[model samples]
Target: MAGEQKRFARFFFYLRNLREAALHTGARAEEAEDRGLELLHSAETEAELKKLEEADSDTLSYVKRGLNRIAFGAVNDAVKLVFDADNMTARDIMGMDLFNVSEIKISGKNVLEIKFFDRQKALEKLGELAPQLDGGGESKRLIESIYGRDGDSL
Candidate 1:
């Protein structure tokens, strides 16, 4: 009775904490809470909780990698190969990395069109994940160096 209540209280506490963390990591509120609940329900012991944490870390890393891939045009090689080939084949199309591609269209005249997921959006998300990559401090230093630290040189 009391023990079960205590366990549930602890569980809710950790679920709220995890939701806050997920929100900080850019998840929507509902999504954060839902995922937190799901993760908490999946874990029974401290060791299981640690394993869940590791799995979450791995998922975040995978998302960051995917964002980098989209932001940096990592799919360009495949796209270029497909474009440069004299004749398009199923194999060539199958080998292309189209994860970043949002849409494809072909007109009656055989003009192929490829639209990609927004690179700028991907970069912004990556920046949110890694704020140090923004280079704000470096930019400030460069500005101060040019303006004698007071902007009075102008």
Candidate 2:
């Protein structure tokens, strides 16, 4: 009906207007951000500007570390998926030629050590193959010791 058509027209008109307004708002926000950066760069003293720059760099580094942690977590999950229990054996992963596995003494017991080769592929394989004798926490800690990082700053 004509009423429905008018309603739809009004809806689209409002949507378009909102979109335009959002675009303008975004532009203004960007301009304001640029001006802020300009003002920061135009600090009263060189030492003050250098301090601000250092703070910005520190923030960027923290962001990078957080991103890296997220990325590493994703990769670790993917590795767990790819290296399931059935894919590898708990004992003798690097049988004779891989040279990526070794025996290490841990708490008076001999345990297999995995070298972090290419995004921890070897470690992932070892984790999959590690015996679940201790409800899996032992194996998880083993892997974490090699790759775990503290991100207190983030």
Which one is best on TM-score? 1
Candidate 2 local lDDT, residue 137: 60
For 80-132, candidate 2 gives per-residue lDDT tens digits of 42355246654533322231112222334443333332435534543454443
lDDT of each prediction vs. the true structure?
Answer: 0.57, 0.35
After TM-score superposition, the amount by which residue 18's alpha carbon in candidate 1 deviates from its true location, in angstroms, is 35
Tens-digit lDDT string for candidate 1 (30-97): 59667545544643433454654455454555576567657754455347744765576778677555
- lDDT for residue 4 in candidate 1, whole number 0-100: 32
Q: Which stretches in model 1 have alpha-carbon errors above 4 Å?
A: 1-57, 75-86, 131-154
Off by over 4 Å in 2: 1-30, 44-46, 52-154
Q: After superposition, how far is residue 138 of candidate 1 from its true place, in Å?
A: 16
Predicted model with the maximum lDDT: 1
Model 2 scores a TM of 0.16
Q: Clashing residue pairs, candidate 1?
A: none
